[model samples]
Target: MLDAAQEKTFQNDILDKIQSHGWLLGESNKLNKQLVLYPEDVIAFAKAT
Candidate 1:
């Protein structure tokens, strides 16, 4: 399990990245989730979920 400080550091890093790069983090998450989804359906599913 992660310690409190490690978890806080991870969250801070994610927040910092999101603040610096407008929605790229969300997009990357969408892309990662789509790895198991159909190629043509990825975008639609990404937006829906």
Candidate 2:
């Protein structure tokens, strides 16, 4: 399992990738909110992005 610092860095990395690609939209924000409670979704979203 990732430490808190690593988890935060991972989340920021995902967010940065989304922002850098200009792919974030309303639905993506909703998905990100879901990610806070369901971290596994991050991997799926990252793959999709």
Candidate 3:
């Protein structure tokens, strides 16, 4: 689990990347109601990868 500060930093980094790139598709875990980066996001990261 991330501490408060770590969580904030992590969220900021994600927001920055999304702003620079495009929208990311996230998958939601119904059990915990937590969202995670989806496979589609990884594929969208790079075209040559």
Candidate 4:
């Protein structure tokens, strides 16, 4: 299990990986949830591969 600081580091690592793979990150539009979504192009790319 990760401590608070270690958890932050892990999150950053995952985000970096996502960006490096051409995935997107952004704030959610709905008030009920907060999240980042990987855009459709990333899914298309993966399907093509």
Please count the clashing residue pairs in each candidate, in the order shown. Answer: 0, 0, 0, 0
Query: What would the TM-scores of all predictions be?
Result: 0.42, 0.46, 0.43, 0.55
Stronger candidate by TM-score (2 vs 3)? 2
Clashing pairs in 3: none
The global C-alpha lDDT for each of the candidates, from Candidate 1 onward, is 0.68, 0.70, 0.66, 0.72
lDDT of 3 by residue, 1-49 (tens): 9999999999989888996787643446422334444555556667647
Question: How high a TM-score does candidate 1 get?
Answer: 0.42
Q: Of the candidates numbered 3 and 4, which has the greater TM-score value?
A: 4
Worst 10 residues of 1 by lDDT: 23-32
Give the per-residue lDDT digits (tens) of candidate 2, residues 1-49: 9999999999889988998998553454444463453355566788899
* Candidate 4 residue-wise lDDT, 1-49, digit = tens: 8999999999999999999999766555522333344455457779999
The candidates, ranked best first by lDDT, are 4, 2, 1, 3
lDDT of 1 by residue, 1-49 (tens): 8899999999989899888976433444435464654454566778899
Candidate 1, after superposition: displacement of residue 15 in Å?
Answer: 0.2
Q: After superposition, which runs of candidate 3 have C-alpha atoms over 4 Å from their true positions?
A: 22-49
What clash pairs does model 4 have? Answer: none
TM-score of model 4 relative to the true fold? 0.55
Return the number of clashes found in candidate 4: 0
lDDT accuracy of residue 46 in candidate 1: 81
